[model samples]
Target chain A: MNIDAVVDFNHWRDQARLLLQQGIHPTAVNWSGQQQTQLAFDSPPATAESSRAYAAGQVPKNFIKLARAAACYRDESRWALLYSLLWRLTHGESHLLHLVTDPEVKRLRHMAQAVRRDAHKMHAFVRFKKQQINDREWYVSWFEPSHLIVPDTADFFVKRFNTMNWSILTPDACAHWDQNRLQITPGVDQPNALIQGQMSDDMDKYWLQYYRHIFNPARLKTQAMQSEMPKKYWDNLPEAALINDLANGSGQRTQTMLDQAPNDPDRLRLKSKKLRQQQDAIRSKQYPSNSAPDQWMN
Target chain B: MQLMDKLAVLADAAKYDASCASSGTTRRDSAGGQGIGSAGGTGICHSYTPDGRCVSLLKVLFTNFCIYECSYCVNRASSQVRKARFSVAEVVKLTLDFYRRNYIEGLFLSSGIIQDEDHTMEQLTLVAKELRLKHGFKGYIHLKTIPDASPELLKEAGRYADRLSINIELPTQQSLKMLAPEKSIQGITTTMSRLQAGIDEAKSQRKNRQTISNRRSQATFNFAPAGQSSQMIIGADDSTDGTILQTSDRLYSQYRMRRVYYSAFSPIPDASSALPIQAPPLVREHRLYQADWLLRFYGFSTQEIVPTVGPEAGMLDLHIDPKLAWAIRHRDWFPINVNRAPLELLLRIPGIGARTAHKITRVRRHRRLRLADLQAMRVPLPKCRPFIETLDHTPAASLLEQDNLRRHFIPPVQQELDLFQAPPTPLVTAP
Candidate 1:
């Protein structure tokens, strides 16, 4: 880049600093000034000493200096710094301009990707199961998020279900809702192990049956289907356990599941076998005996 | 077909119109419904922005094939554009696919008047029916009601749709007739009236059901639970701001519309002889929106907003916003005591939005707020300064010199001749 053609980089840097000091991001700064500055000289490392001092709880001489320096750069880099700073403050970890990891790090990396997807699922799925607990009713939902979304997702749950007493239990963290006063705590590795009694069983069976009933055979696009409801979550979802059997020998299983008797007629018992029969009946009614339509992708 | 490609074209086409709102509804998932979703009263529904606007749904026309040729519509029948019609099953499939992918929450389905309005409307209604009844889709669905469609089809449309909209085409009856010769202002208003009547009937039915059936009303006869809203194309016809507001005022008063969307008319793909080659200033649409908000929320009347007549007199000033224009014109009203001003007067202050005005009112109850408290609340003090008198601050009484203060607000900054000239030194610097 020709230095002569370049406008004053330092001037833009100063302007950016002024903007940041005033709590403004210089997103709409003149493009000419931006093009002029060489990255090495123009993009100053703000005041490292002041940042260090401020982080250590010492009053720095220039409180606004760092913000100003942050503003001086083009918009993208400024946002990058802001996010990096926020990440560092929250996680107490910083590795700017570098990437290094050991063999064991790959597991965590994979886990992180899974967690990201699960966070999205937590946002997407995790249907609340309404139940009566001791006269005061509440909605209980169990979501096995891949990662730690409890901190973020709790706020959403609180805002959305403010009127109801709800709890979103996950493997890593369990969120409690008492009339919208929400609190999250790190919990046991698996929530399924902790869930009490026949309620979970009945709920799981009901969900599976509902899923089976709604699954349109004609709309099943394999790649698209898997993309939305990944194979990874199949284990946790009870509906997936019956996928192959239902797909291949749906009618037979329907009869066999129906023939099984009710162990406890007096009580609200886990009628998984009966529910599976109902699912089959729904399937037979919707698609009939000829062959499964096999197209339901939604 | 790749859903993304279809979405790109459809969503892009839908973006030109501003009528996809999913609020002001009271629809929810039914028992044994495969999915659980809700549409509540808050108009805070989602929207997408390919250009930074919110994307609420996969808004698209069922087909851009129409019988009536609206001069300003890109999808007008005479325009030579590639047209596609999604089958009932196809539309249902597409909505489910898009929704499942988490690309959108629902569908905002519109169509050009194919064959006839009744024929097109029935097809559109069928798509909603499948989404709700056959598929048990609990996602939000907004169906555009054709103005000439039967009251029966319109009623069925409301049963499934979270929201329904009827485009008024243009502001004034004269403009609508001149531009869209086929479109009847009476037809548009009649549809709106039918929708409102249906809504009232549903509300009564719901009330009656509460007394009759202790159980939740599964009446399924609910009329546009999200409520009916209409859209007007700004700058398309020779409609003045006064005319536009008067029309909107009537729509709100008569049909009880939830909203009156202002769509700035973009030139048709194939321009008609009557249509302008150039697009209207998008800012005019924005101004209309602001004006509409003032009417609905800030308690401004049509007469107050566009009181003057003449070619330029009756319109909103382009440079300054509508509210700011009002404040500048009505200087006698301001220098209002922030500590003591009523909610109505406080709302009239430029840059002090409804939220801030409410905040000021609330904070004043506990402890009177000084200028600092208002500043902390994020109220734009620069504009507010001319209007409000706090404990620590007051506008110079001389600010009532209308022209002088108006100039200050707009700021007499000299536009650069080219790029080289230096800005003149400031005459006076306010501390």
Candidate 2:
């Protein structure tokens, strides 16, 4: 069996099933994709054109789930690897998927891990900008994910921000939800068309302001932040614009705070005896000294 | 005062809380509701602050106006810091605005005492109620429960909140009294116990309701699905790491708390005389978190993690991580065969994390693991090399027992990279 390109997990699953049905071995297959080359199949392409259901009684539910995720990986060998795993599963090693230490199994799990992380990061880093699509308001985000995870991560956005209409555009694929159902589109080499949704958002200022002040100068750990947020995401993130400003000013701001003289209690004493009296009354009632502290503090 | 001004003051006051978790909640979304938002799955870190903390929630205090003066708190009544309060409506609006802009996953609302426990708890719970019942905001709501709040109020807060917490403030009752005199240790424990009961009851009730053929609304029974978490301030008093771990163990064993955050006693504006002048070492906080991870995931006892024979005796080793430090102190347990070791033994090996150890155990079912397998899994080879026996690699007896072994594991001081000047790379994984 031969195939030109496997676009997504579903595409890979469909073709792999066809090959398995015909009893074609992994060694007898050549799987290639992610390029726009002309299609060439030795006998016939591994397509579902004339294919019926393969009678392999349900592949392990766990393997299917793992392979589906692993297929999101960009590694060109991912299809072949998954096909090999599937072949091994039905052919001989029944519990092959459970053997996590097997080099082949380990590789599949690694690919799945990468895909899962990609999907999670896609959810975290995607920045939405409010745009007027048609006559209604829509939230649009332009994200550059490492793998083909736009489809895998779409449902998360649907469950999360489902009350609003939104779309996520990426180089690999695109996902849009209009309250009713989700619509997915094929990959585009360039996102120039998608970028037209909205250039800027006004609420970005409040977000940026929060970002600036929320950072504590006393603790400067850019590596820790970068490890999670990463530098690649700094561009699209509205709050990321202040990463440098916050980082560079941290040392100085911390020094200034440290340099300032401790507040003089005498000044409070000088703020009129009435102010002190009021404080005393509140303090006595608040503390209730030499007694059990109140169980609840409001 | 303007809402923005109040937000600045209250948010600054609330930053001391180390938790901003929005995960582990009863999943809900606004698909059929009137307003916009949703909460489910593992929480997302919408942003990261330079303090190296995930800005997962819109963490803010409902008010910084306090009558009880907890010495460690910036919003203490005796402190000179400015005070501000937010109406329930204002908090709801701010949360929605931030959620709309993709700035946060949810809201974490804590407050200082105002008027009385009932009034304060009412204000806090009202914000959550309005977000859930009125706006139909399904985003995560974490309410910092007051120890003195009525049980009914606490239960109601649980209804609208995904998580609730009562900050213990300090490890020992003595320290809590010395530092936060107005906070009762007895009251705090009672609240924790009550919260535990409420959370447990909700789970059973939800389960039973499901069996009775109720719709998915049984799943959304307005109970706090994320359960309870607590925070403790370190270095504010004389409690050592051992004492701290004991307290944490008790909390876990007694109430089945989800998370315990250890906040270093960092300096705040208008410092208190009762506390230390400088903040505890950052490494101290780092070690506590590491030890905490060992306690939670790696199945290591707190005693094993804080084994003596280091600077700050009975404290965790600052130079290396708690796992590596434990491996070094208990060298007699080294040289487990990675190909044949049990999952527990594999986890104890210095370089092998839970993920790697689990992988080694699983894959070895079909084939014996080798050094190459570890390499493919991205295990830190040097750290594990001296402790584990893989098919292709094994440490010499001398290497494992050498006097300079600890020095070998210590990572060099990292040179600071100016991320601002560097070109942005392709993609970074959100941890």
lDDT for model 2 comes to 0.78
Best by lDDT: 2
Can you give the TM-score per candidate against the true fold? Answer: 0.59, 0.87
**Candidate achieving the largest TM-score:** 2
- Model 1 score (lDDT): 0.59
The sequence of per-residue lDDT tens digits that candidate 2 reaches over residues A18-125 is 777766777778796544434334465443333334554657888888888998888899999998998788766878877765788889988998899888888788
Task: Classify candidate 2 by CAPRI docking class.
Answer: acceptable
Which residue pairs in candidate 2 have backbone atoms (N, alpha carbon, C) closer than 3 angstroms, thus clashing? Answer: A100-B362, A100-B363, A101-B362, A101-B363, A102-B363, A296-B148
lDDT of 2 by residue, B165-237 (tens): 9987788777866677567667687788888889999899888888977576634445678989999898778
List iRMS (one decimal) for every candidate: 24.8, 4.4
Cα DockQ of the candidate 1 complex? 0.02
Alpha-carbon local distance difference test for all models: 0.59, 0.78
Local accuracy of candidate 1 as per-residue lDDT tens digits, B1-431: 34434443444345456665655566454233244344453333221121223345666777775555567775654555456666688678767654433335578888877656789899999999988877667668898898668888888898888778888877765676567756756667667777888888888888888897788845446777778888888766766777788788878887788888887765433445456544556667778889989998999997777647433466776556789878877878978898899999988999989977886776676566777777666688887887888888878877777555655665445222213443222101111
